[model samples]
Target: MKDGGINFISFSVGRYGVLKTFSEQDMESLLAAYLKEHPDALERMHFVMLHPFRDDDDEMSRSAREIHHVAKRMKFFQDYVARNPYDSTILINNPTPRSKLYLDFVHYVAALLGPIGSYEIFK
Candidate 1:
């Protein structure tokens, strides 16, 4: 389907609290490959960063550790994106239990990707 009026490219490169699952290098390589395939779509690319869900159990500890690693890795990602031949935006977020970040994230996708495309991406 046509992506509304704008050609929006949305990619989720990492999972919540899964630090080792995909390193920053892997994400950079993935984006590079994607850019090679869709050369004209880099200007509207949206890289969304999901907030890690922290529970009051063992998972909380894991989440803390993972977030620490992610904090460090994000700097490299930012540098690469800046030097690369693409105009993209990175949304960095830390969701608290009472925060409405999900709603904000949804709105961001809708605004950036358009209504029709946002629904598909939100799923």
Candidate 2:
């Protein structure tokens, strides 16, 4: 959603279990590369990492692990943004349960990327 001047995009991470494959290092490298390539991308993008719980194991360990990984990624992003003062970086958490399938996940993602008038849900 893009409201006033913000464009939001809702992307799912754990829908097909792809997030389970993403190591914390992979996330860090991706963010770093994204920032480096676009330079101004951070200023325009508000990234919302979403992890949807699957079953019992997901509810307990997997979800916690994913959150921890995301937290670390956010720390790296925050540090980078601090070093590059000109860039605007926003990272928000919106971990939901896969029980809602993907709808709840989309809503959570939208909330993270706030003040947006339009949004696209990418699975």
Cα lDDT computed for each candidate against the true fold: 0.35, 0.38
TM-score of each: 0.22, 0.24
Best model number under lDDT:
2
Off by over 4 Å in 1: 1-20, 46-123
Position 46, candidate 2: lDDT: 33
Candidate 2: tens digits of C-alpha lDDT, residues 1-123: 235676545444542223322333545454455445445433333331333233344343443343344434454445533443431244444322222222332234344344554435221
Top-TM-score candidate index: 2
lDDT of 1 by residue, 20-58 (tens): 223435444434444455453323333222212433345
Span of 10 residues, lowest total lDDT, candidate 2: 96-105
- Those runs of model 2 whose alpha carbons end farther than 4 Å from true positions after fitting are 1-18, 47-123
